[model samples]
Target chain A: MTTKTPEQINEDLLRPLEGTSPRYLAALTFFVLVVLAGAAAFLHQVYAGLGVTGLNRPVFWGFYITDFVFWIGLSHAGTLISAILRLSNATWRRPVTRCAEVITVFALSIGAMFPVVHLGRPWLAFWLFPYPSERGIWPNIRSPLLWDFFAINTYLLGSVTFLVLPILPDMALVRDRTTGWKKKLYHVLSLGWTGTPRQWSRLEMAMRIMAVAVIPVAVSVHSIVSWDFAMAPVPGWHSTIFAPYFVCGAIFSGIAALIIAMALLRKFLHLEDYLLRIHFENLGKLLLVMSLLWFYFVFAERLTTWYGNGSSEMAVFWPTQSGSYAPLFWAMVVCNFVIPFPILAIKKLRTIAGTVVASIGVVIGMWLERFLIIVPSLSHKYLPYSYGSYRPSFTEIIITVATFAGLAMLYMLFSKIIPIISVWELKAGEVTETATAPALARPEQVRAD
Target chain B: MASVNSIYGLFADPDAADRGVNALRHAGVAQDQIVVMSSEPHEGHAFSLLDHKTIMPWLAALGGVVGGACGFLLARYTQVAYPEPLITGGMPLVAPFPSAIVTYELTMMGAVITTVVTLLITARLLKWKQPLYDSEISYGKILVGVLGPSGAARTDLENRLRSAGAEKIKTTGQL
Candidate 1:
């Protein structure tokens, strides 16, 4: 049997579709329009300040902050899956790793911006950074808000590095295959990769090390984000279980985002053979697990608060269970826990379509969960005298829409530059004995089983 | 100068590159000279014969220490310099718990940043220079580059590589 060289394999893998299709152009146009609308809304928010939001004395943290946490949570899915799977040597992870890593980068970028947007004055946001200025006073180190600045920045840097490192060889492939502008782009990005054994060894070692190191940081980043609420002295806000609760919620939302992304890429890029039903099935199982964990945490936190019968806590709990926010609360429960647990439990319901529905539900549910966490506690403060209702203004709604649009636009732009799938890893896995061994068996022998 | 003769290189399926590396060593190639390269970083068991060392751990640890120190200094110095500090619930000037949060965040930040920077530096990235690379390597090929002396010996080495499933063998400028 003749073995193919690396160059031959790359040509076979990438030479299929070299030019832009009509569908791609249409998608790009739509993405550009959404982004412009978002930019306009963002500019309005800048002009109006925090007055444009639904925030007040009590309910200061609203949709922008919640969405910030939500996006950060979504970012975790990519890094967690890529890093953990890479370390474990899970061959199935190859087709999805690049997309997963890219999700982390884009989500982090979008998520990190929310804290800045949430600030009353967007211009003074640099105060969070430790820069000596004319003013003698520094930002409070004791505040969890400051902790978020450091945690998020670190997570973002780590994720970008993780995403870029593995794509070097693939970029080299693109460099060789294209000409003119695309060729120049890939050539600059490829960084002189010769696939020399020494370079490969160092690259592999670095990635392995990063895969192991990044997991805890990803967990910590979100946990610190959770602390922004938990550290507050407010009745419903201060809870011990908030860290794990937020982490599970984050993972649940993250997996949903991953499913959505995977589905889109599979459709657009024609990656049916690589990203198969088995991949979706595994992801469905993960979503189910996160759903149950979220339910358990939510239940446990509520049960303790209800049993304690603290008047202050009861005020917050009543709104969530049977008061103004009750509908959103119940909807969150059904979407996050009830719908997912039953539907995802069955193997047949774990199909791509079923998983997509469950994923969408979980995304909506997770959003409500964040709202429930932020709003009720603010609406039912300890003093009760200061507590007031929050009605999100048009500016807040438009800005929120813009953030979502911006996220989609970033992802759309990324797909154009990098192959959504890690071409090298996918091809590498394809050429392996383990990858090829299944084909070597006789059909009769395999059918006998 | 005594000229070296034959050089043999072994190539394997991307999945079994590590195993092939082991087998090649068992077949008598020196650990120092044999090189195994692949698209993904499989576990090191595949390259046990070769020295596998990395500077990331050291860099990460150093970053953690520096970050921790900076965090402590930031908290401690701020408290010392501010004559009239805002007291929350009559708490101590230097609360250990809050300070711990600062330390933990900075430590993690340092470690992660160092790991990322070290990876880029060690990988020799962003140089933007082009090199001779077969694009098929991205399509799941494991390449083992080996060097040996001229003529008949090189031919024998080529035969070994061919038998071991090495494809498209070509010599580099005299090494």
Candidate 2:
């Protein structure tokens, strides 16, 4: 570990915020264009109605729902992992926590957009909320979709707080360093932080509370998301095992996303020195564990279904195993398990680049997993004649691509606005290290006299 | 003792700041009157004035309870308010399971929001008027703020800070 002087740390952390390079502008323009294209496609879908996307009988939910589940699963990357690591007192998490938390906020925001997008009358999405209306009937409270609303909104609120709170001191730092409009903006964001003892105390206390509180919220969010499927009467969808299974998959996918994000940031932001090898190795180990756990869950879920021998469920299962969706299913297994296992498990190949490679596969695999899960079961619902395949239309593909571009663009924007690294937290880590080292060296130093 | 005076001493080294804070205390500066501001949080330092009491714990709990209550009301009222309450899947009118989901989410949301608000109020954030501050704090300097002692003690405080290796010391009128 490098011991950085406060001046060195300040300069390093604030480098990204100094000025936008030409490359940043170019990347931003590309993403913006992608976003615009996506918006146009979505508008086309709206103008043409839900028919633009392939929503035939028995397979109403398709790519949009898959994207919804994928992005929401990705949202688990930040708050839950960060909260867990923070509560556990992991020293290595200082450089990582903010990045992870940003993912949660943005992914949740993007994921929440889908339910509306998928709703045929998209503008009337507010009907989902419990409100007094001309229609005498309320939206069903017994529905898991309603549960999803409450859980996701709660998680988003917690995530926003979790992301913004630690940023105050750093905002104050920027407020002091800059002049003109940027300074004015930062001044308001910093909230008059004078760094008094009380400020630090309250900050630490709030962080601890958030760290503890957000974990359950994070867990509930994915569980509720899983319940969206499990609560249904459809064969493959209704199972008691779905909650933990989905939560595990969510974390599994979430960590892979975080790793990929960190690697990209390390390269583009030139944070190679700070976001070191150790961080990747540590995260790679985590990915490996999740991979193993994921393999186990997949095994358990599949084994139980195959053993039960229920023809209705078997119809849904066969497509994923050796039938129509078999290719995608096997690809998911390879990506989530096969590709990641050796690369992450073996220390030699678990370099930054190696982990990124594995993460790429995992991302693809997890997305395929969602696609397989939603499409196959929806296609093979009880009636044989109703059983039909679904394919994503051009509009759905365009919008899905746009969401990825949007995520990149948002992250770029956030990086420019603030120090993405938690500068104060890193310094705090250093301070604690130095502060505690002396006591360990000289036990008699504890004397009050 | 002519009048109460406020002073700031800047140090590049954290240990020097620590000693300076102790020196001010020995010179009869009350613990609450001595404020140490650093670019980072330095734990386990002998800076008693940095101690602060917070009501955030109570505030957050209160927020959670309120959120839980609101959640229950929203779920219940929506169900009952419907003039034509359609029974879906023959489930009861007010299902506790689904209501609990809303309640749990709202409870957590309330706690997080309340804690953040409490942090804002306690830290006195976003105020138009800036407080006494040093730009060097951002450049990794430790600043010791000595508030409201007489001129003689302020002079003694200045000497103490200077002797403890302060790079610069600035004295101002009473804050």
Candidate 3:
């Protein structure tokens, strides 16, 4: 990657928004079709009832719950990790933070939809809130479901703030450079930022406070998500280790998703200079650590369950170990640990291609892990007569596929509106070390927008 | 807010901007009267007034306290205050563990929401017009605007800016 002047950087970053291409329109059309298909499937499920899903008595929860967990875990990719890196003074985070922060906001929004989608009466989802109505009742505050409701919404709000606050200056820059409707929209989004000292000061302070404050909220979110299963009395579901295990898995999957998003943005947006090989190398190392930690967690969990030797637990466990779920079980292991461990553990193979491949595997593997955690236990319960199998119906399958498409669509649209790579931050990074250099002194070289 | 006559200087050099700030101070411009506008945050620069003190920490704390209290009360009152208690598995109505979970989440919500609100107000955002704004700052120029300058002081400040390598000086929003 080569160093770029602020002018070149501005031109490169803004190039995506200069005009829409036929290819972009085609891609957007494809994603919109998928979203519409998912909406249609959801309508079918709603009209026909939850019976339209593959949900059965023993295996009541299936793909939707897994997707909820998966999307929620993916949300961890951005804001939490970016916040941590920012607070730790990780300078390399500059190019990556905006991309990651955007993921958090979108993924959280997508993830929060599952609970509603899975509900028998999606319209009554508001009952989850603490609002007292004519029925004169509040939501059960003791339930972990309510806890998740509060946690996810709070996280969504904070993530949006975290994502939008730093982008204000960039938006103002865009506002100054653009014309017509887009310029008008930028005016509102930029919040009248003029790069004044006090504005930047308070913005930085607010970001700091949010950065410090959002960590525990992020941590608690996944933990509470874990508690959704852990609080249950079912054999495999009830575990004290669920909180940390789920949190680790979330961050693990989150980093993988971020790497994938970065790679995609790099290729499509022509940000080769900005999103450099060094970024992939560093994030690959982080992903490698997370992979090891994830392996430790899985090993510890299985070992404890095996040693405890409770019949109910073993009944839930054996299928995952050597029974029906063994294939998905091992596939998950390969995708998450076996494949990624070697690829990421070695430096030469940790190239952009290598990391992307590992990330793809991790994404698939994490989805499987969520599925395996939810379904198998629910399937092979202690009561042998009640033991049942699940295969997702067309409705569930279509909607699940659509949600993935929805995410892709949302991300693509977002990049078109705002530069996927933050322009100002990248420019700042260039001048940070050489602020007094003659190159900076001659700001007249900067192109007039 | 008291209306003050604004004198603006545009510089290409960060060092020039720094020196220009000093000259303004020498010319009797108060620290609060001077504003530095740039495309990037200059956190440690002497001219970077953005490193000024903020009350975000205290506000976050206050918000957390209030939010946590609400969380606790919401949990307690919802479970115990109803005409009929909603209990699970014969457990106590107002379980401390369950209550603490919601308390922790809502407390964080309070802190973040408070921090965001404080940020908006203190940053003086959403205003129709901002003081001393110029499109040139977006094009990599650094702006130093001193408010409340008189005829002679303004000219002296402009001359000081000229010596410090300002590309141009203007009072009517020209960069």
TM-scores for the candidates: 0.85, 0.94, 0.95
Poorest lDDT segment (10 consecutive residues) of candidate 2 chain A: A436-445
| Candidate 2 displacement at residue A384 in angstroms | 0.7
Best-first order by lDDT: 3, 2, 1
lDDT against true structure, model 3: 0.87
**What shift in Å separates residue A150 of candidate 1 from its native position after superposition?**
0.8
Chain A only TM-scores, each candidate in turn:
0.92, 0.96, 0.96
Worst 10 residues of 2 chain B by lDDT: B43-52
Model 3: DockQ against the native?
0.44
Question: C-alpha displacement of A161 in model 2, angstroms?
Answer: 0.8
Candidates 2 and 3, the one with greater TM-score: 3
Selected candidate, larger lDDT, 1 vs 2: 2
Model 1: colliding residue pairs: A6-B136, A6-B137, A7-B136, A10-B136, A427-B140, A428-B140
Q: Ten residues in a row with the worst lDDT in model 1 chain B?
A: B1-10
Clash pairs detected, candidate 3: none
Per-prediction TM-score, chain B alone: 0.65, 0.85, 0.89
Per-residue lDDT of model 2, residues B103-133, tens digit only: 8889999898899989888776756564467
Which one wins on TM-score?
3
Q: After superposing candidate 3, which stretches have Cα over 4 Å from the reference? A: A434-449, B1-5, B173-175
lDDT, candidate 3, A195-273, per-residue tens: 8767877887888898998899899999999999999888898999999999999999999999999999999888888
Give the 10-residue window scoring lowest on summed lDDT in candidate 3 chain A.
Answer: A437-446
lDDT by residue for model 1 over A1-449, one digit each (tens)? 02546455454446433767887778778877877776777788788676777788888888888789889999987997789889889878877788888889988898898888777788888888776666666777777887787778778877887898887877887776678998888888877775655566677776776787788888888899889999988898898899988988888898888988899877776667667888888889989999888888998999999999999999999988999999999999989878888778999889988888899899999988888888889888988788888888776777677767777778877777777777766655654443322122222443444
Q: What CAPRI grade goes to candidate 3? A: acceptable
